[model samples]
Target chain A: MAITVIPRGDVPLGQEHEFFKFVCPPTFGGGPVDAQPATIKFARKLDVMADLPLPAGVKTYNGGNSLRLWLIADPNDSSSNGATFPAKTIRTKKGDVVWVDTGFSFNTHTIHWHGIEPTPMNDGVGHTSFEVSGNFTYQFATNTAGTYIYHCHKNTVLHFIMGLYGLFVVDPPQGPKFAAANAPGAFGFDPVNFSVPIDVEAAWVPGEFDSIWNDLGHNAFMQKCDQNDPAGAGTFTQNGFLNRFRPDIVHITGVVSVPGNPITDPRVSVAAKTNQNILVRLVHAGYTVQEYTLGLDATVIGEDGHPLGVPPFDKYSFPFVIPANTPFRLTSARRYDLLLNSPNAGVFPFQVKFMDWINGTVYQTAQTTVTVV
Target chain B: MKRRDFVKVGLAGMSAVVVGSMEIPPLFRCVARAANLAFDMSFTEALVEMIDKTQVYHWLFSADAGFATTGPSLPGPTIIATYGDKITINFTNNLPQPHGFRIVGTSIGTGVIPNVNKAPANKFTLTFTAPPPGTYLYIDPFYEPVNRILGLHGAFISLPKGGNTPYGGKTTPNVQQLFNDLGSTPQFPGDPWLPPPANRSLIWLFHQVDPWFNARAQAGIFINPDTLKAKFLPRYFLISGKTGAFASDVPNISIVGNIGEPHLIRILNAGLANHSPHLHANHFYVLSKNLVVQNNVLNIDTFTVGPLDTVDWLVPMIRPPDIPGLKSTPLRQLIPHELTTVLYTLQSPLMYPMHCHMEMSQTAAGGNYPQGLITHMIFTGDVDKVPFPV
Candidate 1:
């Protein structure tokens, strides 16, 4: 079957205008190394394109700093810029063919659907035979029911940093039945057509940025520079751009400016009925390592793009519940979908800490507020 | 209206003005475009003058027909090319010793046959197709240590083909911007993110000179190559053949371009040691690494370049109208910004420093720093006049 495709655009967000102001405090963890309140910094900010409205009957989300989880414009729209960072999210049911129009005019790239085992021809990679150019479409089928990731495989080092990836979730066939069977404890009555027994769902993607690296990588001057030339290599040797790994900021959902300050409100909150089970999908879309700890008990129901079940695929996959206060680790491009068992009548925050994989220094911290009322 | 207010309103109003059949203003129409389509270099031995008012013997290359090596622009010539174009160079070696030329991107085999007893062949020739545009280097590989130190190195660049031509062997439309990943529209010529194209580019050829080596070579002393490497101590640092605290201070070394234009900067490290070229007040996009055009590059200020490394970059000659802290000083606040659109325009020309981040190379013979391998990029606006258009 021909897969349905949609188009979206990703516009850069920077300090291009004078109206916007940067409100983050400058420091490693938004705190001073010497322990003093850093003076608030300000600059005219760049315009961040608004996310697309949710499609009819589809879930809506902002992955990073107003980045939409779906197509921003119609595919037939001729006036669009034709470039989208974190290409439009793909939401479908298991056993369905999904075609994504991943073509971009800005650069050469391939979309590697992280978890799907598509045929070599359908898998998007530059070295492989599946690379697409101009306005070609990427077609594949969802054989597994789970949450997965898709990112550019071309120039993996630089293209991925430019935000060329998105989340792809394939729901089970009996989603409503599963939700109805596992009704919220707060509501004594079983609900009809409930989706996976969840009262609320949220997505958290951890990301980092080094403006200098991003800017330099996107520069046109070096586009043609001879990389093999011994005397022409451009290397950064400063604390800010050190060894090409000094990240300016560790951000959540893309709300923070790089090489600047951290914000006071770096949290996302989701409201839940008292005793409701909340499903939180965590995806690590950056190069750094992340550790997410929960203050309330939550069970790991799925990993990568497959739900834990059955003999071949279900071994040690499901029913693995982590007690509150324990941390789970996630490497780059990894995903974990957790079903949280909300505690008593109070707000429980899910704490996440990001750190460098090489060293053990905390780069950033974020909390997702789970308000159980 | 205040002076600043009038200036802003006047410029904004001029955008809408149509002189009968004219769409753009006369001032903008006068803007010039620069392109370096060809190059000619000759390798010869001559007495080299230092920036610190000193003189030494040196073997160098220059575009000058006389093969003049003792001047402000001493390090040979930069070959600026665009994508899809074929470039040919006829090199005449005036030095007593035999030398050959090898460029990175071009398919020139190493021909390091040294001239023994003044051979009949005193010239070399090279022609090649340039593409996958990027910064490259031309060097004398035969006598790597001796000849290179004597300043026989320069930069080569393959610019993006102009007027709608695809680059890097891709079927996509011609790159409107410098890099394929930058944006849809071309950034330099005319764009909201930058001012009008001033039509200029820049190249910084970095090198180091050991006064002792030059003095010995000048006096016809047969210096051992191994000994030279073991006792290597550089005194004078150079950028584009001139040693100065700032690029503007050195004649023919200062890089000047029109404000608001995206200028291409090719920085080549021709020394034995590594040096980090840092741009103050602005950051540039590194367009390539080695000789390959990168799909996605980085924007950096200080880039550590080792010996023989070439870094190609695109620097937009624009800055914030007024820095948040420097608004009080009239000298610092010159650019104009629209209150409603929040867009910035390069109103008055400005000068920014480009120097080595190594800190020590900025000095002459280990004296005060900021004298060697340092220069300035002049963004010519109404406030400053440009001596060299490109």
Candidate 2:
């Protein structure tokens, strides 16, 4: 059985930009310096990104500034985790549990389950509190199917600065990972359907440091010099918003670090030999308006996480652009169940594109090189 | 000491055009005669007679040349003394603002501290017994933030006790021999290649300043007292306490031409960043800094110093005194050329500078102050090396 995938691309930037001041030495609380994970128990405190018509001109190119948050997680905080829905390319059978554990200070992550509504508790941000630093489980019941996304909601700036968001899909049948575990006489009332996992969660970001360290206030000296003399008109700048969202590379593997791993790594370094082709599921997790179009530039064996009416196993190309600000449902996080016919013997390089406003710097992210012996 | 050595001219009714381009500016020169070489220094205290008294704004600079003792444009005066001699430097502040000077390292013998502007000028006395042989800088921390901008400094050269030269290396009859053994940069062409013939010396001071604005960011700060208004916003820079065409008044370093002798360049830095100071036509070796350096390989062009960093470059001998290029100048043509022709001198000898490195630091903000930064190392054409281009 294959898992069904969806792309809940249309997201709303309700109350897009926010600023919070944090004084050092804790003017209010000389309290604990390291608060493992901050809690978002109040619904009013968290902002939602969902279906909304953004300014047409504001494409991925003008991926503006980022919101910064300092998250210190306690030893246990899975309850504090937020959730998302799925991407538009997964199809599955049934009875498979897709689990996503929220980590802290590591990456920016927040989850949203767009299509499958399970009340606000499963919404992730202000709805449920899995409490980060601790572990929580989301079971993708083989009953429903849809698309969604997951990302860091609290202290988002820090998370996004590092890259932590993804897409997911769900199918009514059991996933492939669980199929091998099924026993010989396991079929009872209605045969149980399992699904497969197609891993695709990547992010591309370049000019990482310049955007992080820029401080707008420090440019005073430069400004003063320019005022006294007219020599430098536009060539130099003294001040600007510090560490504003200005990424040059938009990576696909979800992970920005080199050498992505197929299993744990959004930095996926694949582990396989020739004659083996694996399917992959992708998710969208950024604030800027995205028209995510995924074209295999190869073949189409599956759609929406499952086999098409008559699967075109032959080499082909299909491009699907995910709308901006998508959500991730828990069930879709598992994987997209697509059959791989013939695998490429060597690792092939892949990539993705993102836009930054005007001086749209850092636009392309390196793709994972799939390795097959 | 016999006479015919120096011709001191009062800077009045005399002005010369910038003789050359940045690439080849006139090189003014000066020679330090051998006799009465010891610096005449004294520590005295004075009370400001009135509130309207002239203000003392002295700019200061320092250099750290590893271990060897060298001279400084501080040519102002040497705080001379024998090893073991007790010395006291008393500073009297005639102007406003707080001031203090503390030597970097040791308390006495080794380091020195300047006068404090806070205490009435008559109150403090810097006392200490001179220590081991070495050249060190005595800094004035007085209103330190600003005093350095206005120069207030001198050199501390202690003479060797018994029968020894004030210098540390093995004894030699002249300063050149001390330079040869345990020295820094060697000699090259022109007035640079050979050592000065032990003559009376003068300082070639170099420094920087801003014509307008201070911490307050005020505009057109430097003004004329008579009109109590800024005459012109000076975007100009300076060396040896002057700027513009007027800067020519500052003396140059020169010597009687000796084709094979080397000369000294005592360079200093005041505040104002950006400096890639260079000398034209000649390449020099840096020998004695605050002290001399070991493993002295010559050829030093441009070295950097932030604000008050001091450095020394050795001018070497390139041509023999018989070269016709050097024969025309009055000292050589009007006068007779002789051996050690490198001892060239103008009516009076002086040392000009290569030029300041802070690109625009040499010019005024807009094209306002026409007299950009320039100085010359004057020498009488009679000296030995190839005659300097007219």
Candidate 1 stretches greater than 4 Å from native = A1-373, B1-41, B62-73, B82-88, B113-116, B130-132, B163-198, B223-226, B249-259, B325-349, B378-390
Native A-B contacts reproduced, model 1: 0.00
lDDT (C-alpha) at residue B274 in model 2: 31
Candidate 1 per-residue lDDT, tens place, A25-133, comes to: 0111111111112122111101123343322222212222332221122243343433233444556676565555444444344566666753223344332232344
Best candidate according to TM-score: 1
Docking class of 2: incorrect
Give the top-scoring candidate (lDDT). 1
Q: Which portions of model 2 miss their true places by more than 4 Å?
A: A1-373, B1-84, B103-122, B130-137, B142-144, B154-166, B170-178, B181-197, B200-202, B211-236, B248-261, B272-274, B290-292, B320-353, B364-373, B382-390
lDDT of 2 by residue, B192-237 (tens): 2222223222233444333232311122133232221122122334
TM-scores for chain A over all candidates: 0.65, 0.40
Q: Give the per-residue Cα lDDT of candidate 1 at B37.
A: 34
